[model samples]
Target: MSEAFCLELYKDKVVVSYYAEKFHGRKTANGERFNMYDMTCAHKTLPFNTIIRVTNYANGKSVDVRVNDRGPFVAGREVDLSKGAAVKLDMIKTGTAKVKIHIVKMGANTKQSAVSAAKAQKIPITPSKGTAAKSQSAKKLVLKSGQLYDIQLGSFSDENNAREYAKKISRAKFKNVALQKSGGNTRVSVIKVDGKDVPSVVKQLEAKGFGNAFVKERKK
Candidate 1:
């Protein structure tokens, strides 16, 4: 899915507004044929054929349309709509309306346009408000104890070798060895530990060519 985007509002004049099918086959400002009946839309700089969702604030109704043509081209206007599109949102009579526009992803071109535009604008991509809370809760479990520790596991094919190595390590030994069998290989991992032991464990592991590892805290 394309990232959510904000509709940039122009100086209060229904800047990027819609036009309908009566202008079908008519020449758009950018020299493309305008087709009103198509579920398409227009924008000032958005590439043609880009699909956008137009939502009427007053009625809370929205219509998705493709950018088959170029724009309202009027000063301060950000988009232009076809007559049919305006009627669907019930904004035709006013000749202009306040609406929120968003891009809908149904294909690659629309996706690229939405992405390129979003990058150019430097918008922050954030999870939904509801999901954001869950993320914060998850992060809270990772405590900082102001100490360092070593965390590790063994993956040698021979069980004896794995045990001997574990015993040789000077740090306190954690016994849980999770042997995971994938295809013909068996891998071992140490999944739990005290927050204080993380740094020392990582340092030892790095000296042995086993790089730093992430810590996962147990949930109560």
Candidate 2:
């Protein structure tokens, strides 16, 4: 049997649909001047200046967006991503895409400054290459005991591809291979059981030629 699974979990995952249009040069609820080109988002409840990982289930794109505004009260829409974030998630043409937003950390200030000012304050607003792709692999991942973990290999535009990849993971000794669909994309993942660690699953994924595989909180 594998060891106790570990991962940082704040139990936060919000299904969101980004902005319907542009909102540049507006003052955010946090008193920060909004820049549509920045990697920021507007959340209704999360404290301002909180950093989050927004994964677009449509195209499998993920980006770190800071929460500096409040909105998306258009019923069913959770938060609104900036123009830059929408671009990163390939949501420009779609306008809104189904997304999973994970709370990463809080910002330095209760109400974070604008992206430009935040950068000037020496805060790291932009993520590195690895940090931006495949679920922020550049950032440190902490593993904790007793929580469930999943090795997500890929999100494809086709459900067949996702099923095929799940088959591969199953052949590699991983169990509970599953396919999840949302926002026009299908994802392949291996649900962990028997106390497996996230890194071990990641290694298995790498051995199976999925070096870009990333860990996500297993849905209960």
Candidate 3:
């Protein structure tokens, strides 16, 4: 894979819809002996030694896993967790849970590159000085007496493309469209519309060929 595929942060958290039970004793893609009891995961592209923290958004249970192998190459499937990891996250109870993956650290060589990339991006550790204005606008928090929801556009490497997509959607009569950047390479476009229209926007986006478009509450 190209270096662009090298991810510093979890691109997105996908709820686990399934797990591998039969592949218990097989060797992992990294040639490490696999044990279903170990808190390890299989990711298609993450460097073999990257460490990712998986938090179950449902219950807030979390476990750190070593990315020691690869598989689950199926489309739309993000990462495959070992039985132990799933158990720790209490995901087996629901058979699935929304997970947030954060790469706190990576392998030795990849670590240097990751650090350099982070320094170059200089991602905001704290809210930036200008964010006060945007925060105020968002928190001005008007209720349309209808609905409020958030839509995430696919992550992208090009900021301009992300901005353009946000602008295009903003012009589509949307009430709000915002862009958030993380680690320089990942830009996400979010669109919020009245709550009553959440399903309509989801259907429209799906019909318009946007993948992974889901409705989330616009406010906490």
> Order of candidates by TM-score, top first?
3, 2, 1
**Which candidate would rank higher by lDDT, 2 or 3?**
2
Model 1, global lDDT: 0.49
lDDT score, residue 96, model 2? 77
What does each candidate score in C-alpha RMSD? 21.6, 16.5, 13.7
Q: Using lDDT as the measure, what is the rank order of every candidate, best first?
A: 2, 3, 1
Worst 10-residue lDDT window, candidate 1: 129-138
- Candidate 3, residues 1-220: lDDT per residue as tens digits? 9332344555446655335567777666566777888878876445677777777888877787887765443435567888888889887767667776666577553544544432322111122332211121123222233555565654444455466556655665555567766665443445556554544555565444343443344664
In Å, residue 134's CA in model 1 sits off its true spot by: 34
lDDT string, candidate 1, 1-220, tens digits: 3343454321222334666546778665335576776566655345556666777777877777776553343434556777677778888767777766676643344444454453332112123322111111124223345422223333343344344434443234444445444454333445454455554554554454333133344444
> What range of 10 consecutive residues in model 3 has the weakest lDDT sum?
129-138
Identify the candidate with maximal lDDT. 2
Q: How many Å off is the CA of 148 in candidate 3? A: 45
Local lDDT at 210 for model 2: 46
Q: What range of 10 consecutive residues in model 2 has the weakest lDDT sum?
A: 2-11
Compute the lDDT for candidate 3. Answer: 0.56
The lDDT, on a scale of 0 to 1, for candidate 2 is 0.58
